[model samples]
Target chain A: MNVKDKYYQEVLRFWKDLTPNQRELVDHSIIKKHFNKGEAMRSSSDQCSGLFLIESGQVRAYIISENGKEITLYRLFDRDVCIFSASCIMKNISFDIFIETEKETTAYLIPTSIFDKLSKESMAVQVFANELMASRFSDVMWIMEQTLFMTLDKRLAIFLLEQSNIEESDTIKITHEKIANHLGSAREVITRMLKYFQEEGIISLSRGTIHIVNRKRLEQLTLY
Target chain B: MNVKDKYYQEVLRFWKDLTPNQRELVDHSIIKKHFNKGEAMRSSSDQCSGLFLIESGQVRAYIISENGKEITLYRLFDRDVCIFSASCIMKNISFDIFIETEKETTAYLIPTSIFDKLSKESMAVQVFANELMASRFSDVMWIMEQTLFMTLDKRLAIFLLEQSNIEESDTIKITHEKIANHLGSAREVITRMLKYFQEEGIISLSRGTIHIVNRKRLEQLTLY
Candidate 1:
């Protein structure tokens, strides 16, 4: 398959059970696009632009506070679908959430009008869409539980471990400030925690880097 | 219409655009039941029971920590549909959440088997279900924002304002413990905040009740 067909196939996997007519509607509705790292895909002021399906690379969905603090709600990876970006189509969600490309990303955008059309015609498409929404909801609920019940240190440890696994390396290239933003905390708090972790020989920090020296100990800390 | 049909009508409003055949499936599938106050509707150990459509009364969805601390995710009032309770039907959500009836609740329960069949055949059913899921996700995301960005005082103020409106009275008949449970804060923290609100003349406290004395001040506090 050519590049365009590849992207089309990526989205089709989610709706494999869709009828031929339903699939035709989806194929006609999607608009494929590319976004470079650090580019904003959707912002607070934008209406429901469309649903985004990440074919490759990464997208970070986050919200900023009125005082300018940022908290990452969740991240979308390859083959992930984001419906919140199409907020205009959803009546209940009105918060100022911004979607930014975390990596050079190629994605498929389905306009709200087409999405509504597909939703009105296909049960498979609707089931798939509802599952996507539920998964995201579960993510947000997990975040709330972590923020409300889990301590910052445990959360930081867990985040680092997850990042390391994602990169498949003990060395993680991330700054304390970025980590702070992701965890919805102050840079100073993250720095303090990192310093404590280093002092305990769990990690070693350098300019814009965190190296896990003792993965076993770090994993233990995350358990609490 | 008989009482049974009346209950079916309550759920049909959500799927008003559904085809006649789809409506027939829904009418045949729904099992209406009543739950007393403080009854557990679904627990972590239970499998996805079914989608719950609240015809009347209230349901509280919450999670309990390993340490036994409880934080409510959100509440469902009359005419609300809770899909999370039917988690088995949705493959993506695996979190352990409990649903409890906060008031004497009369509801319609649609089994996952019938729900899947209906969703597979009707676009309108699918759209309505997706909307319900999206609405709940928005509610949880809002909770995350409130927990992470807003201060205890502001949240408490907003909660009080909302509670007053829900009860349709200036005086809210609720205990500090219940309020803490709703906001996912310590009872002591809630007590301290209520005392502070009283000192500030925003509210007056009595046994099992709180009277909003200065609605303007409370509203102003929530804006922060």
Candidate 2:
């Protein structure tokens, strides 16, 4: 299939109730592009321009504080559509959120004007957009709950387990600084926690990587 | 004006784009009711049944933790619409968010079935729904950022300033425990912070209220 046909199929699969007009608009307006790992797609100062649909690879959506500390709001993977990342489309959302590629990524970008038009013309598009927005809101809410109620140790443990699962391996290749940035904590704090975990025989930490030695203990740590 | 006309004016003001059919559906399906202070509107196990449009007074939307701790997600005031509080209309959203009255509140409830039908039939309804969802998502995102990146002292100061503005009084008639609950922190933590603020002469604490003494200092605290 051609690029347009490829994106058309993806959009159709994702939102099955799209009317013919919406499908036509989406098929014509989408622009496909590729970004290398670590490339920034959206930044704090830029206006939100459109919806991004990831066909392959991963994207990290995050926010940075005035002091330059960063927190991961959520990650968009294959088949995920991110509308909030581009804030210009919706006037009520004004906060600056940055979206960057986690790896070499290929994605289809649908301009906000076209998406807004489709949303205004198609109920299916509107429903799909609402669901997506609600889903992101729920993710942020979960993060807030974790930050408020759960201790750093529990969060770190859960993060490690989630990373392991996402990577599909017990040995995860990540650094302390990267983990701290993702968790919105200082590097020293994460290093100290990892050291404590190491002393407890829960995980074996090496330079730039961590191996889960006692999965049971690590899992137990996340339970509470 | 009659009760139906009273609700009609409110709905028209909130969703100005509603088509005649959509308006008719809303008018026919809406149920106007009054809720006393501290009454629950939606609970953890209940499915969302419809859209709630606040006419007067205030409503608090929050989540309760497994251990009985509570966190205020957002608040609904006069002219505000809350769709996420009722989860049944949207299938992907499953989080347990409880909506309760902070004061005696009068609201117009449109059943989910009617709202869904209107949404499917009217592009105007769809756009309005999308905007509302996007707005709520933005609120949740702000909360996540505050919880993850902001220090408790900064958060408390910001919260107090916001409350002062909301209530239009420097001497706010709210207890430390209530403030703690709103910020999703322990009462002891808030008390300690409030005592420190008192020592710093930024605020004065009494039996059941906190009086802002130096608003400038409290505002400065939130800058960092």
Candidate 3:
């Protein structure tokens, strides 16, 4: 399906009770756009005036600390919007995110003005917001649960498994620096873990890639 | 103001945009109640059918792992809600949370049926959901930041500072066990650090209370 068809479905599922005219309005306002790997759709200090629904590839939303440390708030894949920043938009704060494409990525952005109109006039829009919030809460709770219940090694293994699930390759394409940023760890620590896991035959590493060798064992003990 | 009044004001801001009739509906439906320390609002496998918004005191929501470890997800103090169990309310899953009053706590419960209605019909309720999600995201971001940017001792220190903030006291009315649970660390480690901080004249301990002796220095450092 084309990108518009994807958002067409998202808007349908999002506002299930939307009147035909409202749904059509949403679809009409949404515009599909693409960005390359090195390009940004939204900068850290940009205005948050649109709803982004990803259709293809991936996007990374991260912040840099005052001391130049990077902290990744989200890694948006297909279907996950840059929704968390909507509060900043509502509060009139500068967007605290860097939404950069990890690859050639397509998304649909519906303007905030349109959303404001619908939210004021439409119950379906309210329900849509509720579902979006529910999903976001679920994502945050999972992160909290992982931090509380899983060890660093387990977290690494889970991340690797997730990467494998996303790509159809035993060898996933991502850098240690990127993984370090996402896990909020030093690159040195990630390299050490890669060596350790490789020695244990749990994984194999090549230049800029990691191949999962023991998926079952990785999942079994990764989050135990 | 009384605790109920404090909570009513908090909810008032969240429901500010609702029509008076809609606001009154929530007013009539929500019931404020109080619980003593150690009282359980819902235990493991119990039916969860409402959302509890904390007005006074503290609430600890934890789940028991397969290895019999109590994993604390989120701690709810005044102005917060135990939103981690919301899906259980929505999907009617037997509750995974064991929510207990950490002090003589007062809270209000909005029935799930009412919540579903408000979610569908009210912008005020939608804002509440968004704010809750934003707060949860902030919580996870804090944990992730601690995991990467701070040492174990630093994390414990920040936790203590946060606890002190919540209690609005120079002396923290909590034990090392509580600190360990909240920090996801060992009690032995917390004890060792507490002793060291005391020896360094950074803090003083008596019975179960931890007094901040070097508030200025503690603020400069990551430790509480």
Candidate 4:
């Protein structure tokens, strides 16, 4: 089947209650796009791209501080939706976010004008859009809560475990700098913490990878 | 005029395009409620309280950690709309937020059932609701960015400047514990920082208030 047909079966299936007119608008405006890994797709300061419904692969949405520190807001995987890419259509959303393809990603993009039109004219589109926005808000709030309340060690522990789960391996092929960027910490701090963890027999670090020596200990660090 | 009519003129005036049926639904189900200062209006673990359209006074929305540390997400003032209070209606929103009256607050609440019905049936209601949600998301994201990227001194300086602007006075009638809660810091840390600020001749601290001694220096600190 063609990409549009595939999109219709995958993304449009969620909006089964949409009117014929609304469906027509989506069909006429939707475009399928591909990006290579590490390609920058959108930035908060750039023009708005409409909603993205991921068909495959992965994307990381993040924000860069004035000082050039970056932190991940969230990640989008297969079948996930990114509404912030089209944030320009929302009047009150002032902050900008950056989106980059973490892997070779394919997604269906609904242009901003079409999304703005449908969100105003169709209740189904509105509900879908609002739910996506609310869910994203919850995620951003969770990141904020962790930053505000949790110590660096706990957050790093949680991040390592999460990375292990995502990569489905006890050894994570990630650099200390990369981990620092994700956790919004300095590289030296992360390195020091990792060394301390190594001494505690919880983890062992190689040149560019970390292998969990005691997964239970790492898990316990997250709890404490 | 009665309270309901006042609410119609004040809050519903912005939603002029709402259909008569939608208007009737809101008008019938809308309730005007008053909250005394310091009253806990809603918690994440409690029942959803629908949407709040502030008529007067102030409300603070915050989240509490497992260890009971509280951090302010955002504040709602006159004419501000809070969509998270009715987050229960949105299926994918899993986080709970707590709302309390920072001052004696008067607000008109749209019942969740009525709001859900109208949002599904009326495009105007959908737009209004979505805009509110998007705006609140922006606020929460701004908070997250501050927590992740900024130093405690910079955030404290910004907070003091913001409080001065809001109160229209250089002397803020707030305690260190309250400031800690708002900035998501410990009382001792806040006290130490306040002492530093006082030593720097930026501010003066009393038993229950902070008086800005040098507004220019405080502003410069935030810029730095």
Candidate 5:
């Protein structure tokens, strides 16, 4: 099925068991809008409504470090949604993360107040909330384990294997600086590693681009 | 209110709210039990019926690494409950961590089937699930941040402070080896840092015990 159709099916199924009045209430509470490339759905200190769902295009969620470095933790692609984090919206609390559109995007933003009302009143909404929380928690745990147990080279290899030719038509087009920031390593170290990989014929890097020429060889190198 | 009274009140309010006869259905599904000091209530690969609420005494949860080292992640004390974790009850999945009592303890364990049934249909049960997810996520984030950013010395300082008797006494009896495992560092590093702190008059260590001589100094070191 197409992405839009899949999303529509999901929302419909989520609200399928709910009464018609409750579903209508949620639909009315949702606000749909378009965000341009480089636009922010929400950033640090922006009081937002409830969590948002990414309907189309790509968005990045990142935090800026004390040294003025941006750390992109996760990318929110189509069909994914952000829920539970009230730091950006309510209480006027400061959040370190920025939610920026990587391309022109369309999203649905739900008001948290009404969301809570729905959750407090509806078992269907409560189940949806619990499932979303579990996913978010598992995502954080995965990131934590990656940072702790995985070496930089293994991390790079995993990222390459996961992203290569699988997403975005086999072309990542990511910059060295962004890769360094994501891996929490020095750009020089990445450059040196890439040079080694090139000599080993595992990968080729040229002009802000990296191409995986040999997947099996690359995976073997990551073992070290 | 007394702890026992508080427990019944909270549980009754939440569970009974689902239906007039909800407590009757749930009460028959719960099993109460006691565990002795230094005893494991749950272990890796041990599946149980449901969640355990620590009604009395203390329990520590830890994960054994591939190197046969146990990493301490959390200490559950009075009034806290373990729920929604596969480690607590899920079958066919190895427990991510083990739960053992530090002292003779009483806990109320609920049956998973009943809890699962109610959770899918009951708003109160879903709220409980949501809270558990949030709490676990916070814990994973704390441990992750420590592993990613904090140095061994700083982590050791925090550990000492946490274990120290700050209310009346200023001593910590937990061994340095235990602290090392919790901080994910070597015993030699902990030993050296303790010696340094002792020389600085911030602490004094003697034969399996550490006593804080300067509270302000120790706090300063931690801040550093």
Candidate 6:
């Protein structure tokens, strides 16, 4: 099968029980696009770009503050579906969110008009949309809980551990500025905390990278 | 019309274009209940309770931290619909949320089985459910933004102004502890901030009430 046919199969995986008419609608409406690393895929001010289903690589969804600080709401990887990019169809989601490619990525785009129509006509599509929405809400709520209730040190510790898990390496190749952006904190604050962690023999920091020296101590910090 | 019939009419306002079969299903399946102020309507550990449609009074949905601190996700007033109470049906919303009455409330509930069936059969019902979920996600995102990006003093000012608008009075009848709970901060932090605001002449505190003495300054504080 061609790449387009394979992508169509992937789409069907999400709505496996779609009726013949719904399947035809998706086949006619779906579009595929590729994004380079660090590319802006969607913006709050732009026209609603529609729902995106990641085929490969990853993308990050985040909100920017007035002073330009960014806090990631969540990240979508291969086989993940994103609804916030098409948030305009979802009534009352007024706040602006931006989606950017974290790595070279290819994704299927279902235009808002088609998805909206399909959702109105197909129960399967609607259920998928609601599940996607509910899951995103849970992600955002988790981030809010971390920001509100946890101290900066604990949050940093958690972030470091999470990055280690994601990279599958003790050495995480990320900058202090990037870490601050992820945690919605200042770079200097993150730098100071990293210094403290290093002093406490929890983690060692090198130029543009963080190495977990004491994974157990870092895990202990994340506990209440 | 009786109260139950009146609520049925209100439900129609949401799914106004429902077909006869859908209307009949809702009429027979909807359940009505009342909750006194401060009553616990639902908890994280309880079974799914389906969707809630508030007819009168108010309710708050929140998440509790491991250390027992509570952070409100959002609140529902008259005519508002709640989906988090039926989160189990959404498939991926695994977090625990608690719902409690903030005021004596009368509500209509569509049990999970019926709502699930209706949403599958009726496009109108599915549309209404998706809209309800989207609106709630937006509400939760707004709170997360405030918690992550805004300063506590600014958030407190915005909260006071919002309370004044809700009550249509300059004096807000709430305690520091309640404010802390809503903002997801320690009571001592809120108390200290309130004292600072009092010294700044933006507000005057008396007992459990806070009077906005300088509305202009308080509003200015919320501006970037």
The candidate maximizing DockQ is 4
Among all windows of 10 consecutive residues in model 5 chain B, the one with the lowest summed lDDT is B86-95
By TM-score, rank the candidates, best first.
4, 6, 2, 1, 5, 3
- Candidate 5's error at B145, in angstroms? 2.3
Q: Mind giving the per-residue lDDT tens digits that candidate 3 earns over A79-163?
A: 7776643544443222255667887898878777777677667755655655665564455456546645666798888889878
Give the per-residue Cα lDDT of candidate 5 at A99.
75
Candidates ranked by lDDT, best first? 4, 6, 1, 2, 3, 5
Task: Please give, for residues B85-174, the per-residue lDDT of candidate 5 as tens digits.
Answer: 333322222225567887789988877777777676677766766666556556755665555566666777777887774324687776
Stronger candidate by DockQ (2 vs 3): 2
TM-scores for candidates 1 onward, in order: 0.90, 0.91, 0.81, 0.92, 0.85, 0.91
Model 3 C-alpha RMSD to native: 4.3
Range of the 10 consecutive residues with the lowest summed lDDT in candidate 1 chain B:
B7-16
- DockQ per candidate, 2 decimals: 0.64, 0.65, 0.29, 0.79, 0.31, 0.75
Residue A89 of candidate 1: its Cα lDDT?
A: 63
- Chain A: TM-score in each candidate? 0.91, 0.91, 0.83, 0.92, 0.82, 0.92
Model 5 C-alpha lDDT versus the unseen true structure: 0.67
Best by lDDT: 4
lDDT of each: 0.82, 0.81, 0.70, 0.85, 0.67, 0.84
Candidate 5's TM-score:
0.85
Clashing pairs in 6: none
lDDT of 1 at A91: 56
User: Deviation in angstroms for B116 in model 2?
Assistant: 2.4
Task: TM-score for candidate 1, please give it.
Answer: 0.90
Q: Which stretches of candidate 5 lie above 4 Å from their native place?
A: A1-7, A62-73, A84-98, A165-171, A221-224, B1-6, B11-13, B16-20, B68-71, B84-95, B165-168
Give the poorly placed runs of model 3, Cα more than 4 Å off: A1-7, A10-28, A47-49, A62-74, A90-98, A214-224, B1-32, B53-55, B61-98, B121-123, B152-154, B165-168, B222-224
Docking class of 3: acceptable
lDDT of 6 by residue, A1-224 (tens): 66765766675454566776877787788898999999888874565888888999889999998889999889998988878778777777777888999889999898999887877767777777877777887898788888877899999988998889878899999999999999998999999999999999998888998999999999999886
Model 2 chain B — which ten-residue stretch has the worst lDDT?
B7-16
Mark the 10 consecutive residues where model 1 chain A has the least summed lDDT.
A5-14
Q: Which of the numbered candidates is closest to the native, going by highest TM-score?
A: 4
Clashing pairs in 5: A50-A112, A165-A170
